[model samples]
Target: MVSASSSTSSGVLDGFKLVRILDQDPKHKSANLLGEFASTANDGSASIDQAVLILEKTHFSEQFYRQLEDPNRAPTSDGERTIKAPKLDAEAAVLDGTERDAVFAAVSNLGQNDVYTWLLAWLQRSASDPGDADVKMTLIRPATQTHIDKYSAQRRVMVYETPEMYARKVQPWIASFPPSRIQWVYNILEHKKEADSILFEHPDTESGFIIVPDLKWDQKTTSSLYIQAIVHNRELTSLRDLTKDHIGMLQNIKDQASRVAFERYGLAGVQEGKPDGNVRCFLHYHPSYYHLHVHILAASFTSHPGAVVGQAHLLDDVMDLLRLGVDMKQRTLGYSLGTNSKLWSVLYPDGNPST
Candidate 1:
């Protein structure tokens, strides 16, 4: 990445103004253009000629009128084309190092590449409301081999869409893949939901929402990497004679508890092992918690494995149920559950839990 000159202050004149100009051009209104520029800048690439192309494109745009405005453009005696220098907005001046650091820290915990990717995602998501620039960065999933391959060929940016929209457009195709081959898809969906829950309902208060799809979470879930890491940790712990029997007993209890929870809740679906014993596994999204849980039970619990339960999970489940009840009550009273939210409103009689 080209480092901004430390000697110069960071200002919109160097960045936003140029972008705003380009944005006004009909030809340059395409979503991917800015991202293409950004990606080019990111890879320590983008020759001077390439940068010049972007600059030239933006500099000549109709939005450039703002920077070219001149009250003193009256004809002179010589009739020469004289233009008054445009005044810059004082507030839009370059940011000091402290200010830049503050902004960067607020947006990202990861390094520059991750931040850049996140910014691209946000811009694409917020294109509909360019004036509202409050985009938050969540987590960017690591680049897949496809992403890397595509990046080599050309810059790429992933666009964000509403869950319902995304589900309609992408989920069906993704779901068609076998579970193991699409483990990353499941992880992304889970994390996206989590991110949405975090950022949802605050959109009106804030200008926009951003979700950095958690790549690490996807990696840990989709691959055997996490299990291997855990096994290594256990080996190290095993050498210390750290109450192995106690550990074994705890494991057995956990396994049994998970099985009981799964069977009682009708979660058993996939059998982890033979019929002799139950499978102890973390099932995703049971009624207990809106999370992955360790479900355990004996072999006879069911024909397959499903979800799990724990203290936290149980509490979350109860809270969600209560929340649903409250919504149902609001609907019963002929009111909506929340201001400006249409979700779960106008509940029909069939919507009642007893029904």
Candidate 2:
């Protein structure tokens, strides 16, 4: 077991094991399967509860099979194989009704992909439980190699865009700061002196929210208002580079921003018995323009372009992941791009796009 101290920053839980369950490993088949399970979750297709259920059920089945088929298959010689799995409590595998309900409510509305279908076949083969009818049906006709290859080829490629690339390629178009390209970002920077534009300013962090004119509508009739919050610190490019300090700053911004949304949107009159208007903050993993900015829009807004999983992640979820000691950079994040997007050609020069 790799110690947390060896992998993570100080003050994080030392109990958290530094294991790469997503990568293929000869020794730990079950653990490696967990990685695949995580990828399915990150794919933004299924609910978190659905993903967790699949993972736990698969894990249990793998353990059950190992005990039944090879109880004595523990490593005995140098050449012998050892199969290891994550040590999760039996109770933890099952989700309570409340937990399931909450996950269903908070799940991302990202579009589904073929990777999920391919993953079901992989899970069925790994944890073949004869007693389970669903598992049996899934295994009745296994996925063909061609189908597997097709799905694998379509999987999102996570390219770590270096600072150099961002400077050389992404920054040039934005030097003049076109309104069409960046929306309200240029306007906010240039016209912060105007009263209508500047909503809230946090002097300590040099971050603030600006009301977007073109994207805004009457919040009373329509639930969403387009507001952009900018983080003045240029060092942080995207969610991938967030630190504990940055998370703290983001939380403060979120709390204040939500209050602003509640008041500005006239939610008090509309909120009869329901919770007040929510400020849903998110960041596009591959933003249309490169900048350290968060999209602060009303929770009721559904038309925002960055709502999909391949494009966006909720800021709150990103903070929670950091608190749990997940390394965003090391983790394989899923992304999707349009066939016409220039980014696709630049990032994927080769025919194969799987990362």
Candidate 3:
């Protein structure tokens, strides 16, 4: 009798039945196949399912050595019959490839798992402030502690403060925007996807064109999520041209935009309307980091060319824009954005906004 056993509990052939090829020929290929399977059955890496499938499809020829005694030939029962069991080699039945490749492919088929893996890696990187040199230096911390100490001392002497310290100092700049603007910028920064720098051209040849990373969660909806907006590229244009005399103008418009967006959607919910030919919409996805976001893009917006152009967009672009505006204002005023104005102060300084 020939039987097959699996080496690993998870292998395909773990509990599969092994069929025996019956034959009497000692030199036949079937005998060799059986020997091969028996010899390598405990290798622990071969897939059991594949081996069983191969065995089931294998065929062998068997010759009968004896027949029942005929009545006419009575009493001459000296003929002997022999039986042989040859196990077929599983290799002949299964596809040819490395076992490691097969298992790796199976595990990678999970899409959500892949997404989470990338998201976690990105979050870990972003957790450190972009301005932090220590965080960047940590990238090469494997050198001796003495080397690290020298590097740290040089950086401290050359630069007034660490990257983290700089970030803290500049945070007030972000906080100066109105509450609504601050929230908007925060949403965008948190959700916006980053991509390696790439060469991009403006569709209209307009100078305002700046290449920002394309952000969209799903490719199918990319056309709807992308918008043709102002970008910040110092080389392409002066800071004045980008932020320009619009500091006060942007602030005023931002207030109006926030009030309109909040009143219309935050209170009444998203309704059908043309936000400059782009349908204004609200979406809620349970699986995303930011569950609620308002989606807007011009109806005519097209894709940008880049290796990572079609990546997912954070749902909170509008919020990001507002927050960025607030940050800019804070930088200009040199003050924190979050502090609430006292009632008496508000009356004396600017009067009740409604009044």
Candidate 4:
């Protein structure tokens, strides 16, 4: 949550009286801004009827877009480059009514004019007309036309899965997964086949990893292992599609991973805790590659360089949000990209690299 302030500018956008209102955690710096605004008067001042907050795009790149347009472009060897944007349908499923309208408007206006510019004009209209209480105030990143089409045709469908059904249908898929797909396979069950499938001895007491050494650690200074834990008898795509069973599985894995880290690194190794090393578990909402995998890295191990806000969500926070009855899939999240990331061209064409 970034705090709103009477600031003059941010990043590149200038003039128009800028104010930073959304409160944010300093630890999580995002390249893009996704926020919600209320109709309340500015800073409790009657003279200021409305204040518009502007966030300039900082990581724009023209070459990135050019590369995206190149169908024959060579792929980078690093696993990071292999990760594609989450499926458009997955993204569309998370938006609410107001957000859906805003996105639709932005998509519809493409080619006719600059979408962001159009959005600004619409915001101005809403601010001037006091009677338009239904007007929505949300900043949206322009998406591909394919995404827009999928969003338009999307309908809400709730998926329900029982534990027994999950074990029968989903468990086999986990069991047959190749060792190459996992980061490090931990065998919890005595039987090799069973162990591979059951990464944890118990959902509440044990945990295991499906480590992929190919994916480099975000930080290289630390000696701790970078690993991902595999869930048993589950085929969850991401945190947004979590159920009560998924929540329980997540908590159990966290507990087990933390216990393992503490034993290996002691107090001196913990990054978030005092000296002892701790386990840092997180999930990417739209995983670069799809699968329900929980990252269990050592606190000392820096996260992947590509782990930007809006892209990565802490498992603990996901649990807490779900506990509060919030539907994780229905909320919009903010994310940023490095100049070298190929995703920029597919998602943002108008904004070029800042450099």
Q: Which candidate is the best by lDDT?
A: 2
* Superposition TM-score, candidate 1 onto the true structure: 0.18
**Candidates' C-alpha lDDT:** 0.27, 0.49, 0.26, 0.44
Q: Candidate 3 at residue 53, lDDT?
A: 18
* Model 4 root-mean-square deviation: 22.8
Backbone-clash count (model 1): 12
lDDT of 4 by residue, 1-355 (tens): 1122321222211212323333322344322232222333667744321222222322324545776898776566333666656445755666633333323111111112333321211222233322211122223324334323322312222223334433454334445667556433324222344443332345322232332222453323235555556654434555656755467667777776666545433423435454333656788744664356777766655645434456667888888888888865456544544433334432334545232
For model 4, the stretches where C-alpha displacement exceeds 4 angstroms are 1-224, 264-277, 300-304, 337-355
Where does model 2 exceed 4 Å of error?
A: 1-187, 190-195, 205-222, 268-277, 303-305, 351-355
- What is the per-residue lDDT of model 1 for residues 1-355, given as tens digits with 9 covering 90 to 100? 2122312222211222112211222443322122212224666785321111111111233433653587565445337566665436545445433334233211212223532322211122232432222332222133233332322213212222234433353234333445465344234334544444221111211112122212232222212111100111111111111132233333433443433334333334355332223333322221121212223323343322132222112222323444454321111111112211112212222433234
Better of 1 and 3 by lDDT: 1
| lDDT at position 13, candidate 2 | 15
TM-score of 4: 0.36
lDDT of candidate 2 over 204-239, digit per residue (tens): 434443333234544344365656677655445667
Candidate 4 lDDT score relative to the true structure: 0.44
| Candidate 1 local lDDT, residue 283 | 23
Q: What is the lDDT of candidate 1?
A: 0.27
Per-model TM values vs. the true structure: 0.18, 0.44, 0.20, 0.36
Error of 2 at 259 (Å): 1.0
